[model samples]
Target: MLALRDGQLYVLAPDGWTRLGGPAPASSTPLNREDAEDWCEREGWDLHLLDQVPQLTA
Candidate 1:
């Protein structure tokens, strides 16, 4: 999962959440993983893995 908080973008890594880079522009919009990737690509921002968390088995 990914999140944008306080103008910065973070991704959920194996260890924990990690910041992708510097703060996003004020005009940036909230987006899901796929959309975020596309947005980053079009905007020339670095791409980060957008892996979905695996489901836990009981």
Candidate 2:
């Protein structure tokens, strides 16, 4: 689960990774894993092609 540093709220998941959100670093790099189709559908994320990578852009 992901939590705000000030403890305002959080995201809970039975099985998934959580990130501390912020502007990504200056370096050009990928983040997060490529989830399965079923997993994306279950999570309400729309996977699309972004810069040749399958991106969960929801």
Which stretches of candidate 2 lie above 4 Å from their native place? 1-35, 49-58
The C-alpha local distance difference test score for the whole of candidate 2 amounts to 0.38
Model 1 per-residue lDDT tens digits across residues 1-58: 4566555577656565677776655775667777878865786655654443333345
Per-model TM values vs. the true structure: 0.36, 0.24
Per lDDT, the best of the predicted structures is 1
Worst 10 residues of 1 by lDDT: 49-58
Give the winner by TM-score: 1
Clash count of each predicted structure:
0, 0
Q: How far is candidate 1 from the true structure (C-alpha RMSD, Å)?
A: 8.0
The digit string of per-residue lDDT tens for model 2 on 1-58 reads 2323243323334433344356434563433444444445676745332112322444
Cα lDDT for residue 52, candidate 1: 33
